[model samples]
Target: MAVNTVGYTSQITAGFRAVELAHNKKPIIVDHLAQHLAGAALHTALADYQQLQQAQGPGRSLRVPARNRIMDDFVLEALQLLQQQQQQQLDGDGVVQVVHIGCGMDTKPWRLQPLLHVHWFEIDQPAVMQLKQQLLQQAGAATATAPEPGGADLGSTTAGSSTASLAQTAAASDGRSCVAPAAADHEQQQHQQGVRFPLLPQRYSAVPADLAMVPLAACLQAAGFQQQRPTVWVAEALLYYLPLDVACELLRSMRALSGAGSCLAATCIDAELQQAHLRLPSQHYFSTNKVAWHFSMDELAAAIGAAGWRMQGQPQTAAQLARERYGRETYVALYGGAECCFTAVPG
Candidate 1:
């Protein structure tokens, strides 16, 4: 992939969300924002993904939104529990942190901010983050809330300010913090259209970094991630893109950075499906784009366990989630059983 290009998978994921939102009768997620951000990429990605699903079988396409909904539920549950725990600990409205690893055009903060109050951190490849920022600016999401004077402030509350302050202390020499740069003049000008995205400046931090090369903890800390705070780490559709060792270390780092009452949610192909069904199709379908599935959920779970997280339950396949919970027959046995999502908490 070109260095400037945000690559294909992120666009594809956004496209999948857009397609699901527009087409499905009972879509697992309702995300008009995804459609907005996806823009023209939606058409091409939809066509390509649909073709892949046709080759893979029916219901393959549904996996995207199903996994999304499942992960969304896990994070929401964690946020509720963590928020309550933190409130009790601090004797006030407690702050919980939600970190999205390799976040690529994700709209969770926009979707959940009104329902929950928490600090949001997004980390991703520089190219991907740049594209997302540009999209947000275009969509007027970045400038919905006016920045404080001098423009260093990035949150709407004291919790947001305090986190940014902590990040500034740690990264003062680098001139980076949990705070985002001031919006451009044009973006600020457009904000008057009564445009708003759910996450205002006060609680959202977007950091651009290549996780493989940088210290993940430092990147997050510099973005005002409080290690002692209860956090929910979301690594949706991210582990498979990384090499095995890198993925394992990523889990270890998450575990290390987390404090009490922390949890992790992730989705990946299990080793069995990798051997049973995905091995051939992955190469046939994804190789040209340079995308590859690296580690399975079992491998990831082992790493999670070693890193001090206990599995909440057996990993459930997308097919299983769709069939059992939603009571829909969106099952494709060939590859569906191989794709799985799971949640874990600190042991």
Candidate 2:
């Protein structure tokens, strides 16, 4: 079946752009798996990406480096905090769940070491999900017999170390603490349901759903998501594409599905940036990507707060944070405070 990427082509391009930025050795934000995942669909945005890469020169895109730093830092920080919470819960049933809403070609399950123990649910359009599964299977097949790329054996056990070790520790503490058996069984069931990827970590599952059409909470429950556990909802570069009401509804649904201590980490293009794009000549690749920016920083934070999450850190411009985190030497032009990333927890 031909893949339909209608309103989602920008996601593909963003992944490819990140891959190119990584290739240029500009402060790596994405990992090898993410780069590979992005490359899998390079054909979709090859012309535009290549044109931009060549026109701007390698590692010199106007906004990519800053954007990557901001987005990656927010996700990594949130996952680190979530990992700490998961570690504390390890003495109990300690299984943290992560739901990546609109996870198009996302490679976090493999890239983020902490996520190895996470029950990762990647939700996206049916076609995007299917395509990602296909790509993962091919990649998995190629790497099956080889040791995992980053020198960590998938089966290794070390005390309080990696996810594999954490699982071992949990299983040793109590047989019921391990989520693998049930997750493996569920993985098999998902395979039968046509939402499975053979190469993905057993803890990872993909759910095919159009957030614009289906209720997010229902789809998540059908995928075996549990509300009682500590969940981290990631909506990177996702909410802005949605209409204001739909985006707000998604936040509300997430709030309803979350338990106490649940967290949300998200990135968005604010209204000011959207307006700037409109005022400028349509020359940049971003303008042609068809993304809709509907919220100002205050508006986004207010909506999220209304949905029952307490903002964690002060909202900062992507460029400012990127410069602070990575140093000014790697600085690129800021998108005029038009983009921001932040994290929040249940109020």
Candidate 3:
């Protein structure tokens, strides 16, 4: 069966929006690498974003800004919670493994590599994966050819230059030496053409799979994911695109695959928002035929608990988090009833 590209394309758009926000310096939530990975495709979305910004004036928009910020906050908080757990019980090798589901143009592995000894795996559609690999390869080439900072017009350099600079900066921040140029290039080449790219030094892996058709657990195991190791599973803004039963089944499978000390972090659409969107005369972000289901905070918690996991901390609402972080009255009016974020651990 042919997989619908709607959900996958939306994920890419979200990534593009994140890159836009990062460039504007409103809040440094997403990695700058997202901009590079998105390539020229981001220009259209960004142009729309700029128009929206202008229409709303200064710091307001038709819920776009609030939504983007909220999503970014959710991801940041989830990763932070995952890091806290890893810090408390790092393995003998001092490495943490994370699996990002439906990861479309996300730069978490690249951005977080320098901070921790992490083995990161990103699972997504084959098309998205292919495009990502190409962008990364182009980025590597650009980084290799670009002149060193202070010697040329840095603004004209490619995304590779930015990536290399980020890696070096991350290394410096952690009191470590930068990655060797030759090794970096080799690793990039190895992953560019294959399904499994063993990103050296950082240990990043990009696995192509469609969760609806294949067994996720089996795919991860084949990709070198260890069932006995403590793992962090991230499903950011992905569940709503799946049928309710399918989403629950995925959670159960994840629970079985996870060891005693593993954790899962995810985001879900609020029940009210889901219903409201369903009733709308026309859909904006998702096609009615594509979005199978959406879960409320309570529904999500129940699903997680049923899968043998314990919920940690209160469910974080996007609206509340935005209001707290941005302190704008408009947040209450725009995002007061949007989505939410949460974390869970094996019971």
Candidate 4:
């Protein structure tokens, strides 16, 4: 296989860093550095083999492409806005039911490491989940390896998070937190010292299933869905990959399995830009190879309504929508960062 599990695993993390960096995860170097490390690790066998067989050796290590950061920032801005818009609904219950449809190796879940009380579940292709599970293990192991929590904050989240396995949502979402002061500080120093990765967490299980074809509800049940109850499904950078029909079906199935007050959040582009706006030459964007169901924003929204969903209001203020998310400079750079979302409930 041209790409093995690690290679693909690196790609997955690259994808996450892309979203994070595009939105300006500064040092900026960190994302690029992480990308290259993951890419190298993923393709080590191929790269090493090529060096022996073909004198050319492997290509330059894959790091965060410089151009992507600036451009992706706008795109991420648009996406983060859409996400924040949908995430707003997770309130009052003292529980955050969360399911990340295509979650890569993002530490948000771990960083916001809910106390044991918080239940969390991540869904992705099986291989990808394998990587996630490893990362989560690394984190937990490191927690044990590192100095124990010094104050209320340290032991608080891990001990406090309420369980709601299906949604991956935690009980008390007071805010996002993870990584120790020493660890974060170590990472910062490592960057200054030009070291590779500061430290990574143990991987949690990111379930594997191609939801594009098979309905997820069934697989979910087997994976502890019934134990968790209502789910807050969040799909970031995933819908674009599925055919519209398939996308609609997933949402419908999620609703069918939902008990009450379940929420599903996703980000999609306005199909109108397919030929025009989305035609950017950037290799990082989710183009045809990655996205099977290209669509226009209007058509997507209409499709959602057709599927019985009502678009919820966003946290849009006086500023133009995209600008508010990533600022005017980035918004313009990223083609107004066109994206939208819906938070529909069963009536």
| lDDT winner, 3 or 4 | 3
| Model 2 lDDT per residue over 1-347, tens place | 35554324534544555545545555446445544455534554455445656554555433443555566556667666766776776365566777888777666665454334556677778777666656566554221211223432222221113223333433443222224444355345445645433333335446777766767776666555667877888987778767767787888889889976688888776667766755544544345344446666677776777777788888776666766776533322223445677888877
- lDDT for every model? 0.66, 0.58, 0.56, 0.43
TM-score of each: 0.79, 0.71, 0.68, 0.53
Q: Which candidate ranks first by lDDT, i.e. highest? A: 1
* Candidate 3 residue pairs in backbone clash: none
lDDT tens digits, residues 181-249, model 3? 454564565456552423433344566676776688756654546677567788777777776677888
Best by TM-score: 1
- Sort all candidates by lDDT, best to worst: 1, 2, 3, 4
**lDDT tens per residue, model 1, 1-347:** 23333445676667778887776666777877787677666886577556656666544435676777777787888887776676677453466788899878777776653333466787777777767766766765652233345545443222123334545644543332233333344234435655565353235667777776778887778665778778899998888777877777788899999987888988888776555443455343344245657778877777766667788889888778877777654534334445788888877
lDDT by residue (tens digit), candidate 4, 1-347:
14334336446545435433433434232353333324344344334323433442322221222222332343233334433544576753223245566655443343332222223456666555555445434433221112223411221122112223323432222233333343355345435654333332211223456565546775454333442344556665566556777777777776677655555656565444454444654452334443443565566677776665665664121123324432422211222344444345544
lDDT of 1 at 93: 43
Residue 48 lDDT (model 4): 31
lDDT score for candidate 1 against the true structure = 0.66
- Model 4 weakest 10-residue run by lDDT: 151-160
